[model samples]
Target: MVRKANEDSLRAQAPVFLVADGMGGHARGDAASQTVVRVFEEHIESGAPSTPERILDAIHSSNDAVRDLSTAGDVGTAVSGTTLAGIAFVDAGADSGCQWMVFNVGDSRVYSWEGDRLHQVTVDHSAVQEMVDAGLLDPQHAESHPERNVITRAIGADEYVDADVWLLPAAKHQAFLICSDGLTKELDDDQIARLLASHTGEDGPSTADVLVEAALGNGGHDNVSVVVVRAMIS
Candidate 1:
């Protein structure tokens, strides 16, 4: 846990919530994450119609900021980087219910909590994840893998970054979670699911606090952040 300064950034709006986890041990990580969040906030606050393309554009702008900041003098040495993950509302055309536009970069994640179960919605862009996908690593063992923290894609790592995006129909009685790898490192999917289910119907902020507490109890090896949002028909 970073006391004096934190590298995690959160942005919340109805149907639009994001979590950016700055890479640890990197220079200007906090600034990198802040830049990412600021770009999204500006887009949202601009009063422009929200669309999937606009969200993607905002992420590109964020990437530009992170890339620029990472190469600035003292901050360039370590190369600042951060994981971006979140959901945005997407209109599904006339007479169709809205859908969720989910995107992710690096190891931070987005999860769907439905039917009393937790389903990871975003694929992690990390070395360990690649190993798991290739059948070279066991999911259980991957947790402690030396390359677990080696993210393959990050917001500020290069000139361009592509995020994995998914669109899912909006559904009631479902909850969405956006969190940093810190939370996942301390709690497995089952544990997180159980904890979230136990707090069903509770407010998002309360559940978020519980999650942070759980991570801390399990040895918070890194900065932890969580955002819990329940889907509802407005």
Candidate 2:
């Protein structure tokens, strides 16, 4: 529900949500993340519906805002950028109909828990992931690799950036999680799974609260941000 000042800015509205994790030296990092959140909020306030094209446009607008800041010397940094991940809900036109559209850039992640399985919905845009994809490194070795934190893409780093988007059907009792690499770097997938499972029942801690606690408890070496969405039939 809330992101640390050290973390990126986060925005959520019911079923539609987004998280952006920033990286840069000086205050540029904070500027980039805040700019993204502001752009997203503006679009939502103007009543923009959850659509792929609309979301993409919003991201582009955010990138431009950051670039403008850099050009205006407001950020005072040569390079500043952020990773983004978000989900939008869609109506399936039936009594129990709903679906989700997921999008991401850089290393921010989205996870879906359905049945008894946990699935990673976003692909990381880091050097380690690239190496794994190229068969130069095993997937299991990516975590501890020296270049694990080296990201290949970010919102304002380049003139343009590509985002990965996917359409998925909604599932009963399913949960969606979006988080920055800070949490993942410290906690393994298994540990996250266990936490999600344990918090599934009654009045438990919100996902954001639980994840923050986990990261702080683990080390809190970096900023941590988490957004969780639970699906329910209307």
Candidate 3:
């Protein structure tokens, strides 16, 4: 709650729900995140499903756009990077039909909400996450790890960005939460699950609103961004 500005940017348009967290230290993070949103907005159409190829192209375009923010003298010394996590409704092949293309570039995350339980869909690209994957650190200690904020990959950190992706069936009922690390830094999975269980889409505030307020209440020192995507196929 004490940050000078909210560098996080998001796109909640249909077919795409994303959260981009700008790298804060010594970086043009706000512009980096905004670049990502703008690139996606320009590349993908609204209120309609997209193809996997188009989404991938948008990811690559986002990296190029964010990288453009750092030019000339700033190339080697300056940093313009951001973490991206989101889900896109895409048309898979004839066999797979329509599905959710869940993708991630850095430490931001996408979680599937089912039966009031949260299941992380995208793996983080952070140092602590690497350690946890290597069995060098316990999952329970990852949040408190000193290198939790140190990400290994970002949109503009490298010339080419390879997003980790997954495919989920276009089920009858599906819900997903795309968020920046700011929310995770403040609240744990149990707290988020409890909040979602009590959330009624038609009543009171939205799920994203409640979650953001809860994170801010927990001494949110970083920018918090959350996007809730729901699909009900009757």
Candidate 4:
């Protein structure tokens, strides 16, 4: 099972298997995250697969909801936005696979782990990430960058947002990890790779719980949320 704050606002569609992370000032963050989750939940509850297109639409809807909430002045001095990542089971040709779709507005991340390798599947929409992309800064320097926490795109920050989406074929027993920056900011890919390799077995959770626990053990300074899923053949 994925873990987050007791008061955390989160949504998950088990059939679709997705997670969203929200960021905003004060309680507004909670509200934004909750709103996105609620939107997805409504669709899934209605027996929708919550396709990639539907996921994108839900994100836009959540963005509108946040904007509306901000305009209504209910949150009061709080700007709201969130990051979203999800997977939908799919069957293409003779192969049964899963489609991985991610929509992130901030620094939260999605990763895929297979064997001893860990791969980051989502790019952060943050200042530090921009710098790294432009070659203005090395990834090694990102951890201590003073502007590491400054994000360039987010929900409710503006009227328009662009999300990166990808379709990946899931392999049997491969693990998918979705988490907030609170966790990845402190843990490196190699560390994550090691944990995934070490804890995977018959008795394991078959997800990324060990990774989340490692981050918390190092001191969970910010809100930490994680969802781990492993693909299996029936």
Residue 123 CA error for candidate 4 (Å)?
0.6
TM-score between model 3 and native: 0.97
Q: Which 10 successive residues of model 1 have the least lDDT summed? A: 42-51
- Which residue pairs does candidate 3 place in steric collision? 1-220
lDDT of 2 at 97: 53
Best by TM-score: 3
The Cα local distance difference test for each model comes to 0.85, 0.78, 0.91, 0.66
lDDT by residue for model 4 over 1-234, one digit each (tens)?
233543234444455555556663435667777777776666554433345556677667767876665644544336666666555553333453445555566677778777777888788888989999999999999989999878877666667767777777655565677777767865788887777777864595643566667887877666666777776644
Which stretches of model 4 miss by more than 4 angstroms?
1-8, 24-27, 45-48, 72-77, 90-98, 170-173, 201-207
Give all TM-scores, in the order shown.
0.91, 0.87, 0.97, 0.82
In model 2, the worst 10-residue window by lDDT is: 44-53
Q: Write the per-residue lDDT of candidate 2 for residues 1-234, one digit (tens) a residue.
A: 233567477887854688888873534678788888888877654323355556678878887776665654544346778888888775535553556889888898999976467799999998999999999999889988998878887888767777788888766566788898888987888888888877854577786788779987888777888888887754
RMSD of 4: 4.0
Q: How accurate is candidate 1 locally (lDDT)?
A: 0.85
- The C-alpha RMSD in Å for every predicted model, in order, reads 2.5, 3.8, 1.2, 4.0
lDDT of 3 at 31: 93
> By the TM-score metric, which is better: model 1 or model 4?
1
Cα deviation of 204, candidate 1, in Å: 11
Instruction: Count residue pairs with overlapping backbones in model 4.
Output: 0
Between candidates 2 and 3, the one scoring higher on lDDT is 3
Worst 10 residues of 3 by lDDT: 70-79
* TM-score ranking of the models: 3, 1, 2, 4
